[model samples]
Target chain A: MIRPANIPRLLLTPAILTTVVTLGVCLVVLLVLSFGRQNYLDIELGLSAHNFELALTKPLILKLMGKSALIATGVTALSLILAYPIAYLIAFDIHKNKLLWLILFTLPCWISYLLRILSWKLILGYQGVVNSSLMGLGLVDQPIDALLYNSNSVVIALTHAWAPFAILPIYVSLEKIDRALMKASGDLGDPPYRTFLRVVLPLSLPGVSAAFVLIFIPTFGDYVTPHLLGGPTGFMVGNFIAMQFGASNNWPLGAAVALVSMLTATLLVCLFIAGSKRAVRAIG
Target chain B: MKNGLERWLVEELECGRIDRRRLLKMMGAAGVGMAATTWSASALAENNLTILSWSGYDIPEMAPAYFDAHPAPDFTLMGSDEEGFQKVHAGFRPDLGHHTSFIVGKYRDAGLLKPIDRSRLTHIDDFFPELEQIVTTDGKLWEAPLSWGNSSVIYRRDQVEVTDSSWGLLWDERYKGRIASRDSLEGLLIVGGLYTGAADPWEMTDAELEKAKDALIAQKPLLRFYWSSQTDLEQAFANGEIVAAYGWNASVAMLRKQGIDMALMKCKEGIVTWTDGLVMMSGGSASDDLAYEFINAYMSPEVGAFLINSYGYGSGNAKAYESVTDDRLAELGITDPDVVISTSKFQREISAETRQRYQAVFDEVKLS
Candidate 1:
C-alpha cells in the first residue's frame, strides 16, 4: 500500500500544511483586519474601506510609500551593480579554494544584523572612521556632517547587509552556466564582451532577478536601517506603519498600509520580472 | 519535582542509560504532571501572579518584600506604555502592568483596569499627593505612582552659548545640524506647541496644531536626527555630534557622570513632566491580594530610594528623598519636587480624537 512515490508526497505533507496554516492564515487575518475600524485601543471588526482609502489618499502616507519604494529600488540597483562583479569573480576566476573565497565573502553575515548596522553607524558617524581619516589626511577642515543620518547612509547599510544574499544567488546562476556557450560565441567570431553580453549575462538573468527580488522586498519593509540612519527625511513606509501600530494605536490603518505596501512591491517586482525577461530575450 | 525529574532525565541521557527519545518522553510526562498539579491548585492563584513592567523595573530590588512572601512573579517586559496598553487591550491577562499617567484614562475607559484601594497600599502616605491626584478619577485611584521625571532641553554648556534658557534653544540656528529632538508624538507636539506659544500645549486648537506642524517642519532641517532612546542621545552628545537636544533627566545625569558638562535647562516656557505607575488588570487570573502586595512593595520608601538613586528618576514616595543626599538631588536637578511640579507642565490625558490629530501633525512633520 505504501509506494515510494507516495512516500515522497507524505514526506512533503508537513511542509505544505505548515505553509497553509502559517502564511495563508496570517494573510487572511491581515486582510480582514485591514478593513476593520479602530475604536480606541480595540479593533471593531466590520466591512469597511475607510482605512484603505485613507492609506491611499493621505499625502503623507503616499509620499512615504513612494520614498520607501525609491530607496528600495536604489538599494537593489546598487546591490546588483556591486554583487555582479564579485559573483562573477568567484564563479569564473576563483578556481583555487572556491569554498574559502565564498566563506570569506560571506563572513560578515555571521555577525548579527543589528551589530552590522551599528558598525556602519560607527564607520559613517560624524566622528566616525571616514570623517576622522579624511580630517587626519587634511582632506577637509571640518568633519563632513552629511556622511551619516540620511537616505544614502541607509542605502549603504542595506546594500552591505544584503550583499551576501545578493551575491550567492547570482553566483549560483553564473556557476550553472555552460562554458561551451561562451566558447561557441567566441568561435562564431564574437568578442569577449559580446560573449559576456549575449551569452553569459542573458543566461545569468535568473540569478540577477532572484537577487533583485530578494533584496527589494525586505529593503522596502526595512524599519531599523532607515530609522537609525535615515535622519529626519529618511523615514519610510515601514516606520509609518509601525507608528500606526504603536503611537497612533490604529491597527486597521497599520494593516491597510502594510497590505498596500505589499501589493505595490509585488506589482513592481512583477513588472521587473517582465522587463528582465524582455531584456533577456532581446539580448539572447 | 519537575526540575528534579528533568535533571534526572538529562543525566540519564548524558550517561547513555537512556536514549534521547526516551528522555524526551519522560520529560513530556513530567510536564503534563506539572500542568495537572497547577490546574488542581488553581485556588491558590496568588502564587501565579504575573507582572508586566518596563524592562529594568522587574528586578528583585523593586519588590523585596513580595519576593520574601512568594516566589518571583512571572515578569514580562514591555518597551513602552503604548505597547503594554495594546497587549492588555488585546487580551493579555497579566495581573499587574506599568503605564504612564497620560494613558491611564484610556486604560480606565477601555475597562481594562480595576480601581486600586488606597487602604491596601501601605506606602500610600509616602507618595506625592500631586502624583496620586494625576492617576485618580471620580474619587477612585487607578494606579500606584512609581517614577516621575522632567523632559527638557539638555545642552553642552561648553560647546554652545545660550543667552536664554528656552525651548527655542532646540531650534536655534547657531546649532544648525547639531541638534536633536525627541522622536515621540507627545514630546514633539508638546515642544512644538510650547515654542509656538499655544495657550495649552496639550490641548491645542486646529490653527495651533497647524502652527506647531509648520514650526516642526522648519526645525527638521536643523536636526541631526530625532533620538528615540536616551542612550542614542547620550552617545551623540559624548561624540560631540550634537550640542543640544530635547532629553530627559536620566540623560542629564548620565552625561554629567561621563564629564560632558551637560546642563538641563530650566526653560522659560516650561519643562514637560510625566509620571508612570503600576495598575491592576480587571480580569487577571491572579488574586487581588498578590497584586496589592506587589504594588505596596514597589511603592515602599526603600524601593523608591533605589529608583531615584539608581535610575535618576523622581520617586513618587516623598519620604524616599530622606535617603538621597542633597548634593545628589541637586545633581539630578530635582532639588524640590514641589517647585519642579509647580513650574513644569504635566503631559496630561487627551481624547482619542485629539491624540489622532496630534499624531497626524507629528507624522506629517516627520514625513515632510
Candidate 2:
C-alpha cells in the first residue's frame, strides 16, 4: 500500500467500472420503485411504505418468501451433500483420468437447464414414463401424484440443477490442497478419516461457502421451476413478485420484495465471511 | 448401480449453472402490465388506432378483412386480463381493448373508456342483444361485443363414460388425480358457484361461495394437474394424464385436428359463459372513428365465421354461421347461438373484496 502504483489501479479499473455500472443501474431502478405507490391496477405516486408494508403483511406474499428461502436453502444443502463425494473422488481418487471424468461430469452443463427440468416432468407426470413403468412392473397399481409439482419435486430439480455448481468449487479447493499436509497428518498416527477432518475439510470451507452463496442467491429468486413443475399450488415468492410486476402491475411491491430478499442474502454472506475469519483466528 | 449413476451423469453432467427458459416471457410484469395504462392525452390528429389484445385474438386471419384492405393498425398483446388492466393504469396507451364483460363497468368507472357510438357501428345490431345489455351500464354501451364461449365439460368420450352432463366428473372418485382444469380463480370459483346451484356465479353470496369453494377443494384430489397453457393441457390429453378436463371450444376442434379423439359435452349444470368486448380507450377516442369502423367491419358474417373457424369461439354476429358450410358449423357445435347463451350467465364484475374472497377460496381449493 505504501508503494501503490497507477498501473494496478488502471488494471483493476475496468472490472470495478463494469460492476459499478451493472449494480448502479439495478440499484437505482429498484430503489426508485421500492419507495413509490405502484398498485396492481393503478399507479398513484405517494411517499409511503405501502409496498414494504404489503410485503410484510400479506400472508400469501410472506408464505411465498418463506418458501423461496426454504427451497433455496434446501437446494444448496442438498447440492453440497450430493456434490462433495463426487468432487472428492474426482479430485483425490481418480488422479489417472481426473480431467476426462471432470469433463464428463460437466457435460450436462452444456445442454439447456430448462430442457433437463422439462424432462423430469415427462418422467414424473401421471402418464409419464416412470409412472407407466411402475404400473407395468406392479410396484403399485397407481401413478404417484406426489412425484410432480411439489416441494419434493422442486428440491429434486433444483438440487440436480445446482449439483455441478457445487462440485467444481469443492474440486478446485480440494485440488489446491498440499499433499504434504495429508501425508504429515497420516504420519502423526492419525487415520484416513482423522486426516480428512484435520486437513481436507477445513481447507474446503472456502469452496463450500462460495458454493452456498452462489447456489442460494439464484435459487432464492428462481421463477421458472415452480411455474413449470410447481403448478398453481406450488406458488413461490419469486412467482408472486413476478406476477406483481407482470400481471398484477404492482412494481413497488415487487421491488420491495426483491430488496428484502437481497438484504437477507447480503446479511448471510457477510455473516459467513465474518464467521470464517473468526474460526481461522481461533484455530491459529 | 452404474446405470443409475450414468443416467444421473447424463441428466446432470454439467458442474455449472444451467438455466434455460422455455417461455421467452420478459422477467418483470411492470412494463408489460402497465402496457395498457391509459395515456394522459391523445395527439388526436392521428388516424392510427392501437388495439390491445391476446396475440392469437389479433391474428389477421381472425381480424376484419378490411384491416388487410386498409393499412394495418398497431397492436399490443397482453399476457392476461390482469396484465391488460395493469397496462392501462400504468399509462400504456391503446385505442381499444377486448376484455371480458366483467371489467367494462370498472373500466368506465375508472374513466379508461369512451361510450360506444352505436350509429357508427353498422353491424352493432348483429351482436346478440344479450351481450349489448350485459356490457351496458345505465343504458350506455361501453364496449362492442366480439365473441363468446362457455366453460363446459370437454372430455374423451372414448375413455370416460358420459353418464351425466353435470360437472360431477370434475371430482369423480374413479378418476381421482387424473382430471385437469384451467388455473384461473374466476374459472374455478364461478364453476364452483354453478356446481353448488348459485343463482348467479358472478354475484354469489359469500356463504354460497364458501360452499362452492369446498366443492372445488374436493376436486383437488381428483385433479391430474392445473394448466396455464395449450401446450400443457394438450400434452395432458395426449399422454392421458386427464380424462375429462375443463377445455375451451377451441381445444375441442384443435384436439380433433391433432387426431386426438375427444368430445365437448354440454355439461348439464349449464355453462359458465365469458364474453369479450372491444372498448375505446379515453385517450384514444380521437381515433374512435377508426376504432368503430374496425369494429363494424370485424363483425361482418364472413369475418365472424372466419373467427369461429380460427379460434373455436362463436362470433357475436348471429348470421356468421350462414357464411360457413354445415360441416364447419357442425365441427364447432354452433347450430344455435341463442340456445348456448340461454344455458349461461355473463360473468359480471365483482367488488375487489369479493374477488379476494374468491381468490382465497381458490387457494384453499388448490391445496385441499
Candidate 3:
C-alpha cells in the first residue's frame, strides 16, 4: 500500500484538474461581468466601480444586510441549541442500527424545502391548525391574532430549516472521537459525566464550529422563508440584496452588497478556522 | 504497472497533457450538454410562456382550461415582483408579465416590455377611464388593465363592530390583540401617513417617512400578525382571529359568501387601490401572431369568470362580468368595482433613491 504515494495523486489528477478549471472559468466570468455596465437595453463590456459607490448609499440595501446578519446569527444559535443534544445521543448512546437513526434525522431534510416552509404558513395562517386547535381546546374566548407574521415567525421557520445542517456536522465530529479515550477515562478516576465534559465536549468543538458555518451562510442568504413568514417588517439582508439585482435594477450595489455579505461570511469562516486551529493546538 | 514507458510519459506530462485532454473533453461535453439542453430546452421553452406573476396568479387547477382555450401563454406564479423581473433579466423570458401599475413605465424604460395595441384588446373600452388614463404613457398604451381593487378594512361583522370610518379602527387600541395589517412597506406607510394626517401618503419625504415608520413600528406589539396572502388573510378573517386588516374587495366578497360578517368601506383620507396590468414582452422569440392569440384568449369572458371566481379579482375584458351569474357577480365584488376603482389613484413609479427612502421609512414604520 505504501509502495508509492503518487499513485493516488496521479489517479485523482483528472478530477482535480477538471474541478479547478471549472471553478477558474466561473471566477473569470464573474470578474469580467463585475465591470460591465448594465444597460438592460444592451449588454456590453467596460470598467466601473461606480456601481459600488451608489449601491452603498441605498437605505433598503443597508437595512436588508442588517436583517440578514441578525437572522443568520439567531438561526445558528437556536439550531445548535436544538441539535446538540440529539447529535450527542446519536454519537454516544445509539450504537446498534446507528445508520437508521442517521436516516431518521435526515428523512425530514430529504422532503421538499419549500414544502416544509409553506406548511408553516398553513399552520400559522388565520385558519391554521394552531388556531383551530387552540379554539377547540377553548383556551381563549376568541382567536388570538398576530401569530404568523413578523420576526417571531421568521425565527421559527429558519430554526426548523437550519436544524439538519447544524446536526450532521456535530454528529460526525463527535463520532470521530477515539473510543479508547472514553474507556481510559472510565478506567481511571473520572466518571462518565466528567469524561464527557473534559474530553467529548472539548473534542467536538470542530464539528460544532463546522455546524455554525454551514447554517450561518445559507440562512444569511435566505430571503424566501423570511419574506413568506417574516412579512415586510421581517425582511432580511438577502431580500434587500436581491432587490438591488431585481426591481431596483441597481447591479453595482447588488454586487457590492453581495461582496459585503460574502466578506461577512468569509470572516465567519476564517474565525471558525482560526478557532479550530486553536482547538487543535490546545488538544495536542 | 502496465508499462514503464507509458508510466514515464504519464509522469512526464505533469498532468498538463491530461489537463488539456480534460479541457477538450469538458469543452466538447459542455458543448454537447448545451446542445442537449437546448434540444430539450427548446422543446420545453416553446409554448412555455414563463409568466411573471403573483403567488395565486397561476392556479394549477386552471391549467387544463387555459391549454384548451386559444392557448399559448403559461402563467407561472412568482414569489415577488422583484424576483419575477430578476428572472426576466436573467435569460428566462416570459411572453407577457403581470405588474402593479407603478412599474409599467420603468419596464418600458428598461426596454423589457413592448407597447400594446389597445384596439386588439376587446375590454379596453370597458376599463374605467381613470385606469385607462394611467396605463397610457404619452398617448401610447403600454399595459392593458388586468384587474383593479380598492384596499379596505376587512372585518368580520359577526365578531367585531362594523364602522363607516374604518381607518381610525385599525389604530384603535381596543381591538389591539385581535387586529392585523397587510404588512406591506408602502401600504403600511400609507396607513401611518394618513393616521398622522399626511396629504398624500406616497409623497412622504425622509422625515415624514421616519414618522410613519415610527408609527408602524409602534403598532407591532398590537398586531396579531401582518400578512401577505389574500387567501391566508381571508382564512384568518373567516376564523375571526383577524378582526380586520387591509383587504381587497374580491377577498372580502369571497369571505362574505362563507357567511363571515365581512364588510369593506372607505376609511378617512380614503382608500388606496391598485391596478394590475399585462405587459407584453419585447424581443422574445414569440411570434407576433402567438402573442395576439394569447391576448385574445385572455380577452375571453370565460377566462375572466375563472379569474374573478377563484382569485377574487376583476379582468378588463368588458364582457367578462356577464359570464358571472348575477348573484355571483354581486357577491364577488365585480358588480361595480368601477365605483371604488374609479375614485382611487395608481401607484407612482419612483426613482431608486426615492424607493430606498420609501422602503427605509417603511421599515422604520414597521419597526416602530
Candidate 4:
C-alpha cells in the first residue's frame, strides 16, 4: 500500500496540518471577531462592518497609525545602518575565530527582551548613566531630561532590541557573496570603493530587504516600548489597539484595528520588496 | 488598587499560557489567559476549592480562620477585576472571587454571581453600614465589602509649593513637566470631570464629556508621563523626577515610609473613593458552607485589622478600627470612616455604551 511517490506527500502532512491549525485557524477567528460587535462583557457575533468603518475613519486612530509607521521606519533605517558595518566586518574582514565573533556580537540576544528594554530605561532615565556621567564630568549644570521618555528613546530602544535580527540576515547574505565577483571588479581597474558599491552592496540587497521587513513589521506594532519609554507624545497605534481590549473593553474594535494594521504593514512591505528587487536587477 | 501591567505580563509568561516569542511577534497584545486547568476524573472527585483574588489578598493572613480550618484553597491572583471577569466568562470556574463595587452590577447582570446569605456571616453587623449599603442591590447583598480607599493627589511637600489644596494642582502652570497623572480612562476622565465641575462626574452628558476632554487636553502638556504603576510613581517621586502625581493611599504611605515629605492632599473638589470586596461565584463546585466560612473570615475584624495596617487601606468592618491606633489611622488618611465617606464621591457604575464613549474621549485627548 505504501508507494515511493506518496512518501513526499505523507512527509509534508505534518507541516501543512500545523500551518492550517495554528496560523490559518487563528486568522479566520480574528477576521470573524473583527466583524462582530461588543455587548458589555460579551461579543455579539454578526456580519457588521461598523468596527472596520470606525477603525478606518477615526482621526485619533489615523494619527496613531501614522506615528507608528514613522517610528517603525526610523527603527528599520537605524537598525540597518547600525547592523551593516558589524555584519560586513564579520563577513569580509574577520578570518580567525569568526564564529566566536558572531556569537559575541549576538550575545545580547540571549537576555530576555523585557529585561533588555528595562535596562535601557536605567541607562536613559533622568538621573541615568548618561546624565550622571555628564554631570560628574561637569558637562552641564543640569540633567538632560530630553534623553528619555520621547520618540527618540523609543527608536533607540527598538533599534537595540532588534539589532541581532538585522545583523544575522545581513551576515548570511554578505557571506554568500562570491569573492570572485569583487576580484573581477577590481581587475577591471575599479577602485575598492567602486567595487564595493558595484559588486558588494547590490548583492546584499536581499538581506537588507529581509532585515527591513523583519524590523519594520514588529516595530510598527510595538506597544511595550512606546508605553514604557514613549512619554505622552510617543503613544503609538499599538497602544490604541491595546486600549480597546483593556480599558475600552471593545474586542471587536481591537480586532479591527489589529487587522487593519496588519494589512497596511503587508502592503507596505510588499512595495518595499518589489522596489528593492527592481533596484537589485538594475544594478546587476 | 489594580496591580501594574508588567506584573500581569510576567504572570502570563510564567504560566506558559503565553510564550516570549509569540509576545514579541504580537508586539504587546493584551494577554488573555485561556488555559484553564483540565481536571481529571480523580481531580474533579476531590472537589478542591478555588479562590480568585487580588495578588496580596490571596495570602492566608486575609482569611486565617478559613485557612486554619480547611486545606489551603487553590489561589489565582488577578491583575484587574476585568481580567478576572474575562477568565470566569471564558469558563475558568472558581468557588469565590474578589471584585470592585463598580463591576458588581455587570457581574450580577452577567449571572456570574450569587447573592450573599447575610444570616450566615457572623461579622455582618460589624461592617460599616454605609459600605453594606454600597454592596446591596434590590435587597440582596451581592459582595462583602473588604477594603475602601481614596484616589487623590500625592505630592512631595518639600519639593513643591502649594497655595491651595485643589485638583487644579494637577494642571498648575508652575509645575509643568513635573506632574504625572494616571493612565486609565476612568481615573483621568473622572478627575477631568471633577476639575471641570461637571454635575455628575460618572454620568457626564455629551457637553460635559467634551468639557472634560478639553480640560484633559490642556493639562496633557504639563504631565511628565501617565503612570500605571504605583512603584514607578513612587520611584519617580523619590528621585525628584515628579513633584506631584495622581496616586493612591499606598503610594503616599510607602513614600512617607521611605522618609520622603509626602502629603495626600485633601482635594477641594472631593476625592475619588472606591471599595472592593469578595463575591461568591455562581455554579461553584465548592460547598456553600466553605464559601460562607471564607467570606465570614474575610469580614472578621482580625483580617480587617491586618488589611488596614499592612496595606494602608480602610477596613470595611467598623470594629476593625478599635484594634488600630488613632495615630496609625490618621496616617492612613481614614481617621473617621463616616466623615471620609460623607466627604468623598464614590465611583458609580457606568453602562458599557457610556464607558466606550468616555474611553473614546480619553483616547482623543491622549492622541491630541
Candidate 5:
C-alpha cells in the first residue's frame, strides 16, 4: 500500500518533470528569444517588443487569424453534423460487428496525412476523377476549374481528416446512455424526436463538446491542409507563423506569432468550455 | 561505392573478430583494399563530406569523379534558397551549399560563408565570364559558380494562343483563373516590378514597391494557385488545369519529356535570370582541404557535362559547352550566349529590409 502523500509525488514525478523540462524550459527560451533583436546571423539580445508590434499591428496577420478561426469553427461544426449520424448508427442501430464498422470508418487515419491531402488534390483537380468523368459524359465542355485549390477545398480536406476523431467520442457517449431512459420516455408517451432532443442530445453534450475541441484546435493551427488545398485564399495564421521561421529567419517574430495565436486559442477554448457547460445545465 | 564495404570491414576489425592483417587479407580477396588505398593517396582523406544542395545538384551523375576519388559525401537536398539560408544561419553547416547568386550578398554580409581559395579550384578559370563575376564579391571569391537558368512564363501551347510573348500574358483576362505564378516572395515581386515598369526588378524604390504590390494584387484573382514546387506546376500543366505560369526551364524540360506540349515564353519584358553555385560555409563538417577537393570535382568538365546532359541547365564551365551538341544547346535556349545574357536580367542582391517589405507586400497580396 502506498501513502497518499507518496501517491501524489509518484503521479507528479513523470508528468510534471517531463512537462517542466520539455515545455516549460522551451517556453522560457522562446520568451527570451521573442524579445531579442535578430540582425541576420547575429542576435543583439536587446529586449524589445518590436516583433509583437510588427506581428500584432499587421492587418494581414489579423485577417489570417480571423479567417483561421472562422474556418476551424466551420470545420468543427461540419464534422459534428457529418459524424453524428454515423455515431448514432454505431451506438443504437448496429448490433453485430460494431467494431468492424468503427475500424473501417477510421481506416483512412492509418495513411499519412500528407498522402491523404495529396489524394484529395488529385481527386479534385481540374483534370481529376470527377471532372474527367463529367467531361467524358458530355456534362460540360471544359474541365471544372473550381473543384480544388480554394477555401472550400481546405475546409473539405480538414473535415475529412478530422471526421474520425469526431465520430469516436460521440459514439462513446451514445454507447454509455442507458436504454432504460429511452423506454421511460416512450412509456411517458414522448415522441421519438422529443426523446432524442431532450434525453439523447443532453446526454451526448460532453462528447459533442469533446469532438468540437478535438477538431477545432488542430485545424486552427493547420499549415499543411491550407498549404496543399487552400491556395492563396486559404492561407491561415499558421502559414504566417511558418513564414517567420522559414523565409524571414526571425525566430523572435515566429515565437511571438506562436505565443499570440496560442493565447487566442486558449481563450477561445475556455469560452467554449464555459458556454458548453452552461448549455448542458440548461438542457438538463 | 567502396566506402560502405570498407566501413563494414573496419567495424569487423574493431570488434576483434579479425586482426588488421586478416581484415586486409579478406578485403584483398574481395579486391576492395587495393581500390581504397589507390583512391585516397593519404589515409587521412576526409571520411565524409556533407553537401547541402538543391535536388538536381546532389545526384551521383553530377559528381562521379569526386565519389571515385574520395569517400561518398552525404547529400541533404533543400527545396529553396531560403531553406538553405535558414539552415546555414541556424548553424547547421554542410561542407558545401548550392545557393542561388541573389542570396550570396546577404549571406556573405551575414558572415555565413568562408572565402574560397580560387587557387585550389583548378577549373575556376574555365567558368563562363558571367558566372565568374557572380562568385566574386568585392574581389573576394565566396562561391563556386555551377549552373545557370531562367525563371520565365511556361505556357501550354496547345491550350492558349499567344499574340505577344510578354509578362503581360499573366495579367491577360483570357487566362484568368487558369494561370499560375510562383509562391515565392522575391520571384513574384520581380515579375510584378518588371510588369509595372520599375527601373530595376530588384532594389525597387518605395513607389515601385507599391506599384509592384498593386500589380500582383491585380493578377492574384487570375491565378489558379501560387505554386511552390516545380512538381506542383508540372502536375497542374500536365492536367491542363493551368494554361500558363512562371516556371523554370527544368520543369519545362521535365513536362516535355512526358509528352506535355509546354513552351517557355521569350517575354518582351526581361526574364528572371539566376545562377546557382556552391558556397562553402565557415563551420563545415569536413576539413577545408576535403571540402575544396569536392568543390574542385564539382567544377570539373565531367560534372559539367553530366549537368547539361541530364537537366538542360547551362554549366558554369565553358568547357561544358564542348561536350554538349549544338541541337541540345539550342533546345536548352542557350545557343547564343551573348543574346541570352543580354536579353535576361539577373536577380541582384536586395537588402534584408527591402526583402522583408517585399515579403510583407506579397503576404498581403496573397491573403487579400
Candidate 6:
C-alpha cells in the first residue's frame, strides 16, 4: 500500500502526465501549422508569419477579443456574487450533511453541458416560460423578444453553467476556516459583521481567487454558448477561431488566433494569481 | 430481362476490355445504368455504403424508395460544403458525399474523389442541361447532379414592404435592430457582389469587395444577430424579433409551415444559386457495383418526385417533374429549370486569395 502522504501525488501523476504529453504535442503541431502557407489541400512548408500578421493586425479581431475578455470578466464577477451566499450558507448554517447540500448544488452539473444550455435556451426563448407567464398574467400584450439571443443571454447562461465551479472552491475555503478565529474576534467585543469582515472574508480570498480564475479562462474561449445564444452581437474571439478552422479551412490562421488567445489568457491568469497572492499576504 | 448487349458490356468492363469514355458514349446512347439496374437487383455481400450528405437529403422523405431497394447506408449529415471538404480531406472517407459543383474541381485535384461512372447512373440523361453542363469538366463527369436551389431573402410579409426584391434591402436603415443575416463569408460575398452590381457575385474585384465591406460595415448596427442555424433563424422570425434575413429555400418552406407570414424574394439582381450533388469518394470498402446500385436507386424518378414533393429544392432529374403536378410546382415557385437557370446567378469557384480576402472582410464587418 502507498503511504497517505504520497497518495495525492500518485493519483495526480497520470492525469498530469497525460495532459502534458497530449497538449504539448498539440501545441507543437499548432505552432508549426500556424507558420505554414495554406493552399486549399496543400500546406507548403515555408516559414511565414503572414497568418499571424493577418490574425493580429485585424482591428476587428482585437475588438472581438476585448469583448470576450469583458464578457468573461462579467461572468466571473456574477458567478462570484451568486455563489458566495450559497457557499457561506452551506459552510456555516448547514451544520450537518454538508455533503448532501453540495451534491444538490452540483446536480445541474451531472446533466450534460449541452442539455443544460439548451434548457436555458428554451427558458429564454421568445415564446418561452418567462414570456408566457407574463402574457398569461396579462402583464404584457406580446411575448418579449429581447429575453434570448443576445450578449445578456450569453452571460446569464455562462454564469449559471459555471456557478457550481465557483461554489465548490468557495465552499472548500469557507469550510477550512478555523472556528476559534471567529469566536476570538467576537470575544474582543467586535460585532458579527466586523468579525466576518476582518476574519472570514480575508481567509476566503484564496478560494474566491481560485473560483474567479477557474471560471474566467474557459469562459473566455467559449464559442458554443455565444454561437447558440449570443446571436451576432454576442460573438467572441472563440467563435472567430472556430470559423477559421471549420468553414474557412484556414488552419494556419486559426492556429495563430488560438496561440494569441492562449498567450492572452496565460498573461491574465498570471497577473490574477500574483495580485491575489499579494492581497492574501497583506491581509494575513 | 437482361439484354445480351448489357451483359456483354458488363463482362467486357469487368474483364478490363474497354475505356471509360467508350463506356460512357455507349451508355449515353442506350441508357445503360437504367437498363442494367432494372435487372441487377440481388444483394451484395458488403454491409455498409457510407454516405456523407446534407441533413434533409439523409431523410427518408427525400429518397423513400431508395431505402426499400437497398440496405441503408450509414448517413453522416453535413452542415456546409466547406465542412464536408475539410472532413474528407482529413481522411473521413464515406463511399459517397454531397458537395457543391464549384468545389468539384478542388476535390478532384486533391484526389479526394474518384471519377463517377456515368454508365452506372440511370438518371444521367434525365438531368437538366444546365445541371449536366455544371457537373461535366473536359467531357469527363465528376459528380451526379442531385438538387439545385437559391439563396434568397426571407422577410415578413406582415411587417416589411419589400417591393423591389434586391440584396440592397438587407442594408436598409428602416429595418435596424430587426435584421438577421448569415455569418458565412461566401454567402455574404455573394450578397456583396449583388449589392455592388457585379456581374459575377462569386468573383469580386478589389474595388467591388471594398464597396461590399463598407456597405456591410454600415449595416452592422441594424442587425439583431448573424444566425448560424435554421433553428436560430426560425425562432427570430417567429417571435417578430427579426423582420428580414437571408435564408435557403428549405428554411423558407419550414417557416411558412409554422404560419410565420414569411415570403422568399426574387431579387432584381438575380438570386445566388448553388447546385450540389453526390460524388463518389476515392476509397471505400463497398464494391463499385454495390455503390452504383445505391447511386442508381437515388437517381430514379420516384426519388426525384420525393425530393420535389417534400423539400423546396429543384430535382436534378428533369423527368421527375413529370410526376409532380403543376399546382405543387406553382406552390414551390418553380416555373421550370430554364427559368430558374436564367434568373439566378450560379456560383463559380473563387480563387483562394479572393476567398481569404472575403473571410477577412466579413470578420471585420461582423466584429465591427
**TM-score against truth, every candidate:** 0.89, 0.79, 0.75, 0.90, 0.88, 0.86
Backbone clashes in candidate 6 total: 0
Worst 10 residues of 4 chain B by lDDT: B33-42
The digit string of per-residue lDDT tens for model 3 on B57-92 reads 565333334457544354556544554555665545
* Ranked candidates (lDDT, high to low): 1, 4, 5, 6, 2, 3
CAPRI-style grade of the A/B interface in model 4: acceptable
TM-score of chain B of 4: 0.83
After the best TM-score superposition of candidate 6, give how far the Cα of residue B254 lies from its true spot, in angstroms: 3.6
**Model 5 spans with C-alpha error above 4 angstroms:** A1-8, A44-47, A276-284, B1-45
Which ten contiguous residues of candidate 5 chain A have the minimum total lDDT?
Answer: A37-46
TM-score of chain B of each: 0.84, 0.80, 0.78, 0.83, 0.85, 0.82
Which prediction has the highest TM-score against the true structure?
A: 4
Kindly report which residue pairs in candidate 1 clash with one another. Answer: none
Each model's DockQ?
Answer: 0.62, 0.23, 0.24, 0.45, 0.46, 0.35
Better of 1 and 6 by DockQ: 1
- Model 3 residue runs over 4 Å out of place are A1-95, A119-161, A164-180, A183-188, A231-233, A269-284, B1-69, B79-83, B118-128, B162-164, B177-196, B202-210, B223-226, B293-342, B346-368
lDDT for every model? 0.84, 0.74, 0.68, 0.83, 0.81, 0.79
Which has the greatest lDDT?
1
Give residue A208's lDDT in candidate 5 (0 to 100).
Answer: 90
Which candidate, 3 or 5, would have the higher TM-score against the true structure? 5
Q: Write the per-residue lDDT of candidate 5 for residues A4-31, one digit (tens) a residue.
A: 8799889889999999999999998888
Q: Between candidates 2 and 3, name the one with more favorable lDDT.
A: 2
lDDT of 4 by residue, B228-299 (tens): 666788899999889999988878877888999998888888888888888998866668788888889899
Q: What order do you get sorting by DockQ, best first? A: 1, 5, 4, 6, 3, 2
The fraction of reference interface contacts (C-alpha pairs within 8 A across chains A and B) present in each candidate is: 0.66, 0.28, 0.30, 0.47, 0.55, 0.53
Model no. 6, DockQ: 0.35
Give the per-residue lDDT of model 6 (tens digit) for A150-245.
889999999989998999999999999999999999999999987887799889988998998899999999999998788667889998898777
